[model samples]
Target: MAPAGLLDAFWGYERALMANDLVALDGFFAPGPQTLRADAGGILVGHDAISAFRRGRGGAPARTIGDVHVRRITDDTAVVIAQTLPSTGGRGQQTQVWCRTTDGSWVIEAAHVSQPAAAIAAAVWRVVGSPLVAGAASGPLVGQTVAVKDLFAVAGFATGAGVPAFLAARAPAGDNATVVAELLAAGASVQGIAQTDEFAYSIAGRNAHYGTPPNGAVPGAIPGGSSSGPASAVALGQASIGLGTDTGGSIRVPASYQGLWGLRTTHGAVSRAGMLPLAPSFDTVGWLTRDAATLELAASVSVDAAAQRSLEPSFVVDPSLVALATPEVQAAFASAVAGLSVTSVDLGDPDELVEAFRVTQAAEAWMSDGAWVDAHPGALGSDIAARFAVAKGITEGQALAGASAFDGARAHLDRVLGDRILLLPSASSAAPSTTAEGAELEAIRGSTLRLTCIAGITGRPALSVPLMTVPVETTAAAPVGLCLVGPRYSDLALIALGAALMAPLVE
Candidate 1:
């Protein structure tokens, strides 16, 4: 039998967990760097890390203890195994090593949790299969699986675009999008159609209708979108390639936030036929992967070599652009840049270009989806609804002016970039907390747009390399990508450079 007070302490800890009693929970765990709590997400080491996670997690799911088994190893140490029956109808097991400290109170030193596997995560995927669509017999991407963003036309399924009403109104596609066909031909099986921001307009990943997808990197952070689903699927190891589109920062933002390699091909480099468009002027096809090699392989089959232009290995840095990121991101960028050969240059006013890009994007978005949105009232989430409202009000004159400004900025950046690569932070900061809202969220979005809009305006190939990390509350460290903007058609070359840069770190 267990010690006199051991079961009491265990039950007390359970109460604390279900009630989300942070203080009491903290007291239950031994205070040390060696304390551990692990789950399907990842491991949390140290009392501080565990505490931080609990504080941000809102609360644990409602569950009842089903079976309890205890083994007393010594007078002061014991092991406990408990079966948990979640209110949601899942069986899970929790294992913990408990020890009686000098104070004669039992505390958890280490823990491991296992939950039943989910057939499909609704938020991450709208539809899934063992293999939604089979790939070719053999190719470079053989055995690879793809998460096709809902914006892409996957044959036999309607592109939902993260809107229930829109999806209900549309008919199943007769053919796959050009990019989807290319991937299928390259031997990458389609895993399923993943969720995207409503109409692929917003970069923030929260889908108000279906709920937000989990961030694989940061436990309680937003999974950057509109490519949120694909990124999450890849991060969670559900797929090998995340076929997505980046109009503003859909691919890169999520790539950075989730520590994946994302490549936004040069504008028009990959066919947009059969794919949904948020902003035609800015929309470009891209891929997200956990590693650089997978990204390169996926791009090889789609990008045309003849169209690609070779450039020197030289790199450039725009101080003004780097300043747009958070201090932690800025510091990380500086450290990374310090080791690379780069030249400093001025990229001009970011806000001007950002505003111009927004205006143009809004106008295009209104033109593309306004009719549908108008037909169906209250179909969009508050955030996107508000954006569309602004888009609805933009005068044609204002759109033309914004387009003129964008054209000039695009030309200027193209000339400035020449054949050299521009290095910068992929996002303004690490992924924002899930609770962040209102002005704070907008500020982060604005800062990120300032960085992402540069590539969009220029229509250049920008690669988000998962090379840096920033400290976050939910985990020990959250990733922030080091973005590389190259000349048009430099998609393959950019991937090569990123792989080489990451080689040393992986070693």
Candidate 2:
């Protein structure tokens, strides 16, 4: 008979697989060349190959597993066999050789998946809609593969905003979003529409109807959102460029979580026309890419170059802001910033800044989504529903005052930094565990927003440079981003700075 621990591990693995939690799925596999998984498709010879398949596979269909039988080979190894029935159709067999790693976690050393042959979409895309074209493609982004967030209009395609009801209610987009048109004109091809948080409200990446997109850089970690889908595609190499919208920290947080180069363009830097509004006051279009060159290329095609300003590389460090990170993250941030000459500066209480951001963002979100919520009633996820409830409670007087305060804070930041850049943690910590819920989950979100809200409120450009790693419970080291917030219209400059800081990784 298999050991009790082995049975438990199998049960956990099954749950993760059903949820399409790609990060957790990756953790189940042992690291090294000898570790392998074979399926109807082909043999995956090592950890990297298996991981690539998981990232690009769209996701395994929801399935139920039964008749699990485990055979104990030794103290450190066991064999598990189970039958899987996918919700769509057909049956399959899964065989796994489970081994205990040095850190006492169970991982599959070898496995085989056998299922009835069928066609399936790539796992990274939520909807593989028909592509749109803008005349002949010819520009800086030529030959690049692009994936857009479902919130963006793609002409002929439906915009779901990660909610099924939303898609059902909305008509097909009449025209491509300005960013999409620009990318197409520049020679990039559209791949598909990616999933997003319901109405682009949450940074947790979980969607009520479509499901969460997996974090490609750190398996078993949450892919930060409301831009989850775009970040995942870019990190997985499924798409060369990912066009996403950042309202609050959507683009920067996911970029940090997934270890891709992500930018939150300056407010008004890129036109928001043809995109669904989350909070029109703060919404801005941005993107993610694997390297600095691509990041520059995409930015060139999207951003209004005339708005850019040449700034000195002098850096300002905010200790209070940096202290929000976990010790591991703090150390990583310190190391990444060590080579540059740094000047310490204070921006006052982050809590106050976050609260100001909260009020204004909530007010604007309600303005945009309240009608839909009232019409559909129970259409939203519980967490999002609760957030909407909070927004509903905000008095008009409070909202106006909050908006005024937010503007004041922006002016304050602009004056403090002047032509220099502000350095802070991109996220308070590494991505929160998917299992985290209730108050625990709220706390993680709250803490992260405190750090990210700074750039959001200021409407300044911020880049999440994946130059550091912090230890999470399951993985030895997971990525953390160090943010550089620059003055308005400094979007391209920030990307160039991030590229310089991550030169070793890119080159």
Return the top candidate by TM-score: 1
* C-alpha TM-score for every candidate: 0.95, 0.82
Q: Which pairs, if any, clash in model 1?
A: 203-225
Question: Please, what is the whole-model Cα lDDT of each candidate in the order they appear?
Answer: 0.92, 0.82
Give per-residue CA lDDT, model 1, range 304-325, as digits (tens). 9899877788999989989989
Give the range where candidate 1 is weakest over 10 consecutive residues by summed lDDT: 433-442
What lDDT is reached at residue 414 by model 1?
A: 77
TM-score of 2: 0.82
TM-score of 1: 0.95
lDDT of 2 by residue, 10-68 (tens): 88888888777888988888887677787643356678657766764567778888678
Q: What lDDT does candidate 1 reach at residue 47?
A: 90
RMSD of each: 1.9, 6.4
List clashing residue pairs in candidate 2: 23-220, 57-123, 58-122, 58-123, 58-124, 59-123
Residue 112, candidate 2: alpha-carbon lDDT: 95
